[model samples]
Target: MAVVSAEPVKAMKEGQILVTGAAGFIGFHVAQHLLSSGREVVGLDSVNNYYDPSLKQARIDVLKQQPKFSFVKADLANRETTKSLFAKHRFPAVIHLAAQAGVRYSLENPHAYADANIEGFLNVLEGCRHHGCGHLLFASSSSVYGANTRLPFSVQDNVDHPISLYAASKKANELMAHAYSHLYRIPCTGLRFFTVYGPWGRPDMAIFIFAKAILEGKPIRLFNHGNMRRDFTYVDDVVEAIARLIDRPPQGNPAWSGDNPDPASSAAPWKIYNIGNNRPEELEHVVALLEKEFGRPAIKEMLPMQPGDVLATYADIEDLARDVGFRPATTIEDGIARFSKWFREYQN
Candidate 1:
């Protein structure tokens, strides 16, 4: 399915949209889509060296070419600065995507998760509350489903046993957003993105790492002996879901009951959805696809499952499809081909 440009949002027609973490992979793509749709976008990012700042800068450069796009190099953890930006722009909608990503890295530097994911998210919620931002959409993660043995993780599932601080922080974001939504009546939507991949993807992610290792003739380490499964979603599909959701802010669910509450929805204007491919692929299959894309066999190193790593992730995107009338349709073959092409060009 083609990812079409979003329709003009009623509340956003008069003001610019704020895309936090705009320099980040998914955020960059989301901002670009919004900009291409003729929506004015103010992209905010700390541009920190969590990864290579050069890659973030490259994305910013592309956004800079668009006349309607503006960039703000600021950290969300800076409360005063975040407040100033919100007061200045009064964005109709805020897409909060900035966070300290990576489950494994959280073990090494736990404070980064607390500072960026918790404190930074608090700043965003406060901004939306004070500025009367029409809606607040933030990125949650599939990692939040930690320890749940369900075949496909759903928004309705209880996410109480997060194995990593990163997952816990994301869960905290959802809770905090719910509290703020209840108190301030700010329409809040949390998207639990599955294993998202494609062009301009994160270097630390599995696909990128495997591709790089294969190209350099390095051994690609496979956790759980390549037995894991993932619902690897394409970036364009994720972006399209976000774009379609911009205008459909949740109203307080009238059907919500305190007796047996739906974890995915609240009596307040808050909701959650899992945006994923809904098709789980084996880790071995992913590596094989990368090998084929590069036309080189990968030197594989079998390894035990790392702490905080789940064996599989399959998303139940019923809410996303029913609400947005769309679901991710990209096949792994096509998505990997596009990503490999981009990687080859990017390396050159």
Candidate 2:
């Protein structure tokens, strides 16, 4: 694999940075971090009802107070609107985080996946392609490791066997991005995130759902009979990774060869990295932490594993650490405590 450049890929000073899906969980945090660092940011989102529009609105409302942050409510699937957005701002760098994001949901609503994750991403790529983007970072998911029983999935691993449409769409994004980068020399980086959870997390996620169920004294379903593990990365850690990576775009590997191509890097300026906690915790252990934080016992309901679900997910983040000079160190105990505090407050 080619070594990533240590130097920053400098963005144009004239235009504001673009963060798609800024109303969503990770995007919101990324935009906030960029704003705090004094970068003018244009946050775009459809504010779709994937989970709850009110929660999305709450995030947008908070960002509205920041002087350096501007919000644009538009669907990336709308090509004209997306085209106009690019023509208007001519963004120097884009953090594309918006997507139709649910594995189980994709089985029922595959069109949504096609519309958002596929079509929406193409629009973002078009914008970056035409507007002279300095760097383009987009979200991929650890779910792409589907059916692969590897213990600490690495970027070099082949992910051609995604079990769900959601994962397939993300894999497609990586391929699409590689094509754009190869053709246009666009510096593209794909981030494969693990199970991200924290304050302002999506309600559909296990942590949030389990917390809500436990609070209401309802049964929290344990998939695969409570025999599953996940690299539950905290959202703050994810944001920090993005902040560090924003400036360090990949310089194409001159040593790369097509005879034995690496999955994580290419001769073009395209790279993929897994940003995860690197610590896989049992689902039961996470439940125990939540129980301790809430001072209540959870009603456990062991159930069969749902379709389009994996038994475990662990990330190999050595590449990320070596390239970015950081690693995720937050313990699940600390993360759960903080999340519990915020969940309690948000409930009121």
Candidate 3:
């Protein structure tokens, strides 16, 4: 494992930093961490009614408490607003996490994915390029693995046949980021995050839905006949990996050659890594663990897998550990317990 130079992958310090989707779970947590570190951050969001505006507002309310934190209510898909944001504030480092998430939702309403993920991402890239941001750290997803069928998904893996539109959109992001990195020489790193669960997780995620159904004694649908596996990563761990990566922006790979190019690294200043718990857990075992923590057995309703689904998703985090010397260590039991505790506190 090579440590990304301790030279402290420095970015623009004087210019203000912009964080898109700061009201979302991962974005909110990252923004709070940055604010706590004394960074002057401008958080942006549309406050859409995608999930629950109140939950997003609750996150915004907490961020507003920080003197250094400023909030802006706007949509990322709005090109005018995105352009104006860059013009108004010079951002050195742009962290783009705003997107139309959810794999299944893409099948139901793909227009949302195009509007928010593709069109919205282009607006953000335009802003970064025009503003001359030093480095851009954007959130990618483990779903990009698609039909790769490889255990411990690696960034170096060839991700060509994406099964879902949402996956295709994310894969497109990596290509889009690389093109900019080569053309503009902007240091960019894309994080392929595994299943992130914890306090403030999205209501659409399996953890939240499963926990709710189990608590209410409702039949929880076990997708893939309860044979699914996921590298369930904790949110705090995900945020920590981003924090470590913030200081380790990729530089041009001088050794890169067209003869045998690596998919993960490029001649341009771009790189990607998989952030996961490094251990895949069975779906039913996770349910059992939650049942133990909540003291309620789930009503088993075994069902066939849903569309745009995969049998398993495991992350190969060797590159992350080698670079950052850190990996997600929270076990499913502990992680689920944390979520269960938050559920009890919030739902009660």
Candidate 4:
């Protein structure tokens, strides 16, 4: 594995950064951080109803309060619209976080995944290519590890077998990025995020669903009969990693060899890193923590594992640490407690 040199990061130009999916969970937080750090941000999102539009609007509402932030209501699948936005702004840096999310949902709505993840990503790459964007940082997923039985998923591992369309799409994104990097010399970084959770998280995610169900006195469904594990990374930690990477795009590796090519790096200006907690927590333990935070026991309803689901996911974040000197440190207990507090206040 090649070690990413700890080079001094370049400073981003104020008011020239573009953040897609600014209305979504991680996007919202990342945009907020950029704004707070004195960078002007143009946030774009379709605000689709994949989950609840109300939640998305609420996030946008908060961002609108920041004078340095501007919001654009547009879908990335619309190539003309995306192109126009890029041409109009001529942004130097773009954070591409917009996508049709959810693993199980991908199984049911396969075309949505293709439209948003594939077509949308193409538009982003084209925009960066034509507009001379300095750096393009996009979100990948831990689910890209797919059927690999590896204990800790590393970016260097081959990920050719994706059980779910969502995972396949994310893997495709990384490949597409590499192609662009090789051909156009666009510095691109792909971040494979683990199970991210926190305040303003998607309602379809396990943590939000469990918290809502427990609070409403409804039974919480335990998939795989409570035999699942995940590297539940906190939203803030994910945001910090992204913020640091914004200014530190990868330089092409001169020693990259085709004989034993590393999946995480290339001769082109491209790189891949896993942003995760590096601590896999069992589902049962997560429930206990949530119960403790909620001050009520959950009505557990055990069930078989759903299709398009994995038994466990753990991330090897050594590369991220070596490059950025940061790791996700928030424990599940503290993360859930903070989320629970937000949920209670938001409900009232």
lDDT of 3 at 319: 87
Quote the RMSD, in angstroms, for model 2.
0.9
Instruction: Work out the TM-score per prediction.
Output: 0.97, 0.98, 0.97, 0.98
Which prediction has more favorable lDDT, 1 or 2? 2
The best candidate in terms of TM-score: 2
Backbone clashes per model, in order?
A: 0, 0, 1, 0
Candidate 3 lDDT (Cα, whole model)? 0.87
lDDT of 1 by residue, 1-348 (tens): 112123535775668999999999999999999999899999999998989999999999999999999999999999999999999999999999999999999999999988999999999999999988988899999999999998889888899999999999999999999999899999899999999999999999999999999999999999998889999999999999998899878877888888988999988989899999999999899899999989999999999999999999999988888778899989999999999999999988
Best by lDDT: 2
Give the TM-score comparing model 1 with the true structure, all chains together. 0.97
TM-score ranking, high to low: 2, 4, 1, 3
Where's the lowest-lDDT run of ten residues in candidate 3? 1-10
| Local distance difference test values of all predictions, in order | 0.92, 0.93, 0.87, 0.92
Q: After superposition, how far is residue 147 of candidate 4 from its true place, in Å?
A: 0.2
Candidate with more favorable, higher lDDT: 1 or 3: 1
Off by over 4 Å in 1: 1-9
Worst 10 residues of 2 by lDDT: 5-14
lDDT of 3 by residue, 1-348 (tens): 222456664565555678889999899999998888888889998888889999999999999999999999988888999899888886888888888899998998999989988889988899988987877899889989899896778877899989999999999999999999899887888889898999988988989989999888899888878989989999999989887877677877788888987888888889888989989999999989988988988898899989899999888888888878798999998999899999998889
Clashing pairs in 1: none
